[model samples]
Structure formats: structure tokens, C-alpha cells
Target: MRNLLPFRSAPAPTSKVAALAAVTAVVAVAAGIASAPVAAEHTDAHAVVRDGQNIRYAGLTVRIPAAGEGVQAAAQSTSGDISLTVTRSAEGKLVVKTDDHEHGDEDHGDEAHADEQAEAQAVTADSARPAAAKTCTDRAYALAGWKLPSFAWYYNPAGAPAAIAGTAASAISAGTNALSTACGQKRLGLVPSYAGQTSAAVQVGAAGNCIGNDGRNVIGWRAGSGRWLGMTCTYFKTINGKKTVTGTDTALNTQYKFFTTTANCNNAYDLQSVVLHERGHSLGLNHVSQSANASAVMTPALSTCSAGKRSLGLGDYQGLAALYGTR
Candidate 1:
């Protein structure tokens, strides 16, 4: 049995790009079981890609016809199980093969011969893989296509009570500014808008339903066309009722929280600093574990709101410019 991890958040958007053709299936049953009547079955399931950007197979439930008591069949299948061994070929395709059969009766010699032939042919057919299977190379390429937008700050006293409007606007603006400077002058840009009575609510630290539910904070498109990018600043809130503030190796879908520090709203998590970090994700940049580079905004774990050197370091610029082509 394969151990499957429970999904904690919404699944990321998968590319609809067509894949290669399906390979033939191959099956091979044990020779000793050739004397008894054999029965077999097959099925297929889609694979799930995770936030950490890992690929996993969805279980394919198979049902085989029962023969008798001790006269049972041993079934073997491939590609459907979530084993690491099952993977895409160099050309990016999924291959599935299986071997299964029950003991056949020696009295039916001619029938047994026919069954063996059929099983052999089935095994050959199953050996080929499917073109639609997910591949690491394709996944990496798709991730490279994701575009990050310039961060923005919006406020609507009519939408949010005046008491918190100024604070929220100031906090978001500072974060956006700090990020732009660190990510590169034009790399991390900012949009201008405000939350209002009709505007979307903003969460901070751990507030709102930012933690557990599948909803994003910043909605709408900065470019005002094509794909709309959402933004979030993690605050306190009940995610499915939990208290977690940040998520890692995951996309910024409806679920999962985007957290920021309390000092950020109070002008502590420097504007340029926080914006640069969050915008990195907006542009599909994953967090880096480089501890030595204090200037790198993609560095894992937010320590302080200082400058972050306030500009897109070499790594950040290379990654973003590569995706969008340094415009």
C-alpha cells in the first residue's frame, strides 16, 4: 500500500499543454499459474502536483475477478502506484505495465496456450507510457512561465473603518516600496488603489480567515488584462480555524496564509523590504536558504525589516528577468 499525504490547501493550476502519446501496456504472469483460469483488471488515475513543487500519483482503484479459494491470482501493475520508481521517461511520458493471472487447468492445454498468448500480448501493450504524464522538466518549465506583478497598496475608508485604513495603507505602501528597491528599480513595481466599503478586507499577522481557507488578499490585475494576480500579507486569523501564519514551498492560491509582522504595519517591516520578499513569490520565485547573503530578499525566514539591501540581488534579478525577459 502506498502512503499518501493529505492535502492541506488548494491544488495549483496545472498547464493544459498537450503531452506525448501513450505507450503500450505490458503484462507478465508467473509461468506456474498457467494451469488455472486467470482473471485480471486495470485502471488509471491523475497525478497531483504539490505546493513544494513535487509530483504525486493519484491511486488507481483496480478490481479483479475472483477465480476460487487457493486458486487465486497474483496481480502486478505499474505507473499508477505513487512509488518513486514510476517516473516519466526522457521524452516526458508515463509508462504503465502489469503482470497478473491465476492458475490455469492443465486439462485444458489448448485453452491454456491461448491464455498465455493473450497475457503476453497484454504485457507488451502495457509497456508503453502515456504522453500526458507529468514530468519534472515540464514542471520546471511551467514554473518558469509564472509572472510576478508589481505590488500595490489600496485603501477605502468606506470599505474599512477609518481607524485601520491609514495604518493598512501605510504598511502596504512601505512594503511595496521596500520590495521594489530590493528587487531592482523596475523589477518590483507598485500599483495604487485602496480598500473601501466595497473593497476587499486586508489581513495582518494572523487575522481573518487567511490561514486555513482558500482565499487570497490582493485580487485583480495590475496590468488590467490577462491573468489577474492576487496578493496577501499574513496576519492573525483562523485558517480552517488553525493559528498558523505562513506557508512554504506552496503557491499563493486561495488557501494558505501570507504573513507579515506587526511592526510591518507600524512601519517596522520596511516597505521596500517586505514588498520585495512577497513580490518574489508573486513572480514565482521560491524562497532561498542562503544565510550568508544578508542582501538577498529571497532568503528564507524574515529576520528583520531592515533594507534587505532594498534591491533585487543578482539571483532575484536573474530569475525574474528570465521569466519576463528583463522588461
Candidate 2:
């Protein structure tokens, strides 16, 4: 089946298009997920849990299915009892959903309190290690042999309030600027481009995760899954038989209380702080654990309303500078 999904990254070769043809065709065949099902199933609830899992650092539980066959059947999350319907994005980012799955701990009325706990429990995805000036190579999450040096991203407010979308846009722009200044490569910066079309790929009132080849990243709301502020899902493309990463797509949860201003630092999470962390993933950096005493922008996890990470810390810049180089 030929994929009608919008082109995700800058145009690739015919071979790459054919490469997606097989996967997208398989998706069309497996469950026709490109259209994305509206069915809701109740099962276990899941998120970026901290424990022992190889792909855990990336805050994802990955499963590679047979070629020419879609992953919907094989992608359900069995890590726990809850039903987690795993799907794939056009860019191949792993999309996990716990639709209508109610958890014992969910309480939507008090989001600030809920986010406080969620921020503590949920760990963010991968980061980069410093060079000889910082640390040697061979770190676990580091995208060794492959660094996501360049790509363009887009934003789809998805009907968010104008103020909310404006805040988010500013945060994302600040994030890209910080990364560009630190990495010293204008190309590594995540430029905001348009997706040309809108998609409800990520639904509201559920664990909605959407990533587009275009920059139309979505934000949705629901109180039950409020603990998850947002998580990043990276998609990979193999070239010449060697796995190469094309890009990393991110989704932010609207359930959490977000604070855009520097003052009034209540319990809400800072938008720029989270965007900064996820932006690092766009450059192929992994989770580099930071101490509470001196946390970097890539801290594995952060507290509520914490804007300390809005700027680059030593460890954060060290790895970025080493990987992408600085002026």
C-alpha cells in the first residue's frame, strides 16, 4: 500500500519512500492505523517508569515486529496488566495509548498535586555523554555512530487556548535557541515548519501520543493521565543496512498545569524546561542522570514548576558542545 502520510523529514530518496511503503502498507493491512481507530479499550495504565529495561532510558518499551507486517497486533503493552495499544507514527515513532483506561490513582480535579507526584515518578528519555572533556564514548543512551544533526519540526496547537499555544510556541522557540547556541550548529536547531495539514492523530481525554513528519505536534487533555507531563518518542530509519535515526517526535500532556511566566512559580511545570529536555533528544542525546544538587537541562526527571532546567547547565552543555561542537 502506498503511504499517504505526509512527508515527515526533509524529502528522502525513492528507496526511503519505498522503505516506508512497506511499513505503511503493513499498517494499512494490520489495522488500517493510518486512519487511526476510534475504538476504546480498558487495560493497564503505563508511562515512563524507572526500572530495569534496556530501552527504559529512552522512556519507551520498544518492540520490532516482522517486516511487511504492522505492529498493532504485537505492540500492545504487556509490561503490566493495563492495555496499552502501541502504534507507529509516520516518522516511525512508537505511539502508545491507554485509551479510556482508568487507574486507581487518577484524580483530575487537583492537577497541581497530581503533577507533583507524576513529575517525581516519571523519568524523561535519553541524553548524551560529554567528550574527553566530559566523559568518554560508549554511554548507553548516546546515539553512537549517529547524531541527529539536523531536522525541522512543526507545531499543531490542536485547538489549545491561544494563550496556551502562544506559551508553548515561545517555550519551543527558546528551547531551539538554547540548543543552537550550545551546539554551535544552526542546523541542529529545530526550526518550526508547517505540516500542511492537521491531524487528530492524538486524541483528547486519553493518553494521546502523536508525531508527524511535519511539525504538527499535538497537545491533548484529560485528567486521569495527568501525571505524564509529556514524553518523547524517537523514530529510526535504516540506511545501507545500518540503523540511522531520522528524527525524534515529542508530545506534551495538556492535563498538567503549565506556567509560562517566570514569576508566580506555583506548582505548575515550566513549559520551556520540558521542551529543552526533549529538544536534546532531537539531537540524538540520551538520558544523562543529573544530581539534584546540580541538575542539568537533561535531568532524568524534574519537580513540578521547576524552571531551573530552562537554561543549559554544565553537564548539559558539555555533552551538547562535545557532540555538535561549539563556536
Candidate 3:
């Protein structure tokens, strides 16, 4: 059940270990399918061709204008309340403009989702920063906990094409498997559910800026801004003085290439790395004490084409231990 699927940062409320149920506001704060021929090798819109192209960054849709021209391209948000425009103001600058009357609030975020996934691909080089790469040692986060003895997740494969939906299903399953291994005999575990596709219009939900609560922990995608790579908006309640995650909506950017194999690394993002970190959030873990362990998957900053994150570091496991209390 292991897939080499492709694909963190810190923010406020990241270090409050006692605040075990800190909402994962965003990935900057901080899936599924289609079977329609994979979109012709992911059109490279870096230079802006005669045709338009796209990629997903945090589920926002950003359409890149073709022919490398200075055209004001208007793209819509997955939430539909926002309209983001991508314009190249400088010779090599990505100027993003948002017409979203309703702005998302501030929250934890990570490596932003892609600007374009299909025909367009525009990432800000400035956005790329030095990330921590550990020597494969143990890491820990601020807090952790899971409500159910074990966790179950369902995916929505309705709108996307067949290939897309199927891959998401398998990749997410693989991601869950990895967590089960990392948790190491803990009562908390991620179990996949074939409950069915999401009844909600969007696979992922968010409040102003917070990952919204709908009890739909989904793995799906859409077109949007390159703000958050993945996010798990959760609902928690203090049960007997302990933070317990009642529900969550685990979501990823469907617009980016969720690499399932090493061969396709050059284009699509790393699906496993991104999804795994989001799962940590769902488990009541906050960012690894902001500005501390970038080497951990829960670290706030992420880089482009960095597949090293797909694997969990030792410190990551330590955090799990803290959250769930030894195997």
C-alpha cells in the first residue's frame, strides 16, 4: 500500500503544546481525480504559450496567460468568492492580485500550492527559502491527540476524471499507511473509508482564513493561490479537559502533479509529503515549535522539487509519541 507519491512552516499558535487542539488555519499559515488523459503532459506555462495553462496552490485557480505576454489573466478561487489575477509585472516576477471580497483569515501555512497545474506554472523564486534538512534524527511537535481509537477518512471522486480520482484514492491510502507505521501501536491510527464522494460542493472547506469545519476530512483538489500546500481544518472540543479532534477536512491542491512515482518528479508536486504533514495537523499536532525543526515534516517552510520530505524524520515520530503517549 506504499506509493512513492510526490509532493511546512510555522506560524502563531504553533508552540502551545497545551493548546493541543490548535486549529490548522492553513499549511502559509497553513485530491482526486479525472481520467481524461492526464492533460497532455502538464503544459509548461512558464513562458506563457499561445494557450493558457494552470496549477493548484492551496486549491486556488491561477490561469497563466499565453505567449509570455503581459496580459492580466483572471483565475477563480475554489471557494468562488475570490478571483485571482496573475500578471508578470517584472521580467521575472509573479504579481498576484485578488478580487476576493471575502478574504481568508490568518493561519498556519506551508509551501504554497502551485500557481498552475495544467497549462500554466508560475512560482515565485523569492518564495523559495532555505529549509531545514535533518540528519535523520528524532523530532517532536508541541502537542497531539486523536478522538477515536482509530481514524477513518473518505475521498470524493465524483467531479475529477477517472485517473485523477483513482490516484488520489491510492495515494491517500498510502499516506495513511505511513502514519500507522509512524504512530507505532498507538490507539490513534488513520483508517481509510470508502464512505463515498463528498456531498459538499468543495472537497475542502475553510472559514475566513481557517480550514472550515464540516466533518469531511477529504483528499481532493482545485485551482487557487500558491499559498498553502495542504490544510486540515478541524473541529475539536475539550473532552474531560483534553483536546479531541471531533472532525476534519483534510485537503490538497489537486492542480499540482501529486507525484506517485519518482519518474514524474520533474513536474508534479510531492503528494505524500504534503498529505502526511496535514495528517499530523488533523491529529492535534501543531507546527514543530515555530522556528525550531524545519527538518521535521511539520516544519513551516517547504521548497520546490524537494522530495526528501516524503519520509518522516525521527523527531517527527517523537512528536507523535508525545501526542499519543508511547505505543
Clashes of each: 71, 13, 66
How high is the CA lDDT of each candidate model? 0.28, 0.39, 0.41
Candidate 1: minimum summed lDDT over ten consecutive residues — where?
Answer: 68-77
Worst ten in a row by lDDT for model 2: 72-81
Error of 3 at 188 (Å): 6.5
Per-candidate TM-score against the hidden true structure: 0.34, 0.50, 0.51
Clashes of 2: 13
Name the regions of candidate 1 deviating beyond 4 angstroms.
1-145, 148-171, 177-198, 202-268
Writing each residue's lDDT as its tens digit, candidate 3 over 1-327 gives: 101111101111111122212232111100111111111111122221111243222333333322222111122222111222233322333323232111123112232111122211121221222244342443444342334334666676554434445576676666655665442334333343546666564334332123244555565654433445564545454455554555566556555455655565655555676677677666644444223444566554454555656655555555555455553
Task: Indicate the residue-level lDDT of 250 in model 3.
Answer: 54
Residue 15, candidate 1: how far off, in angstroms? 32
For the record, the alpha-carbon RMSD of candidate 1 to the native fold, in angstroms, is 22.0
lDDT-better candidate, 2 vs 3: 3
Candidate 3 — which residues are off by over 4 angstroms?
1-136, 144-149, 159-165, 182-212, 289-292
Worst 10 residues of 3 by lDDT: 1-10
Write model 2 residue lDDT over 68-104, tens digit each, in one string.
Answer: 2111110111111111223344444433332222222
Which TM-score value belongs to model 2? 0.50
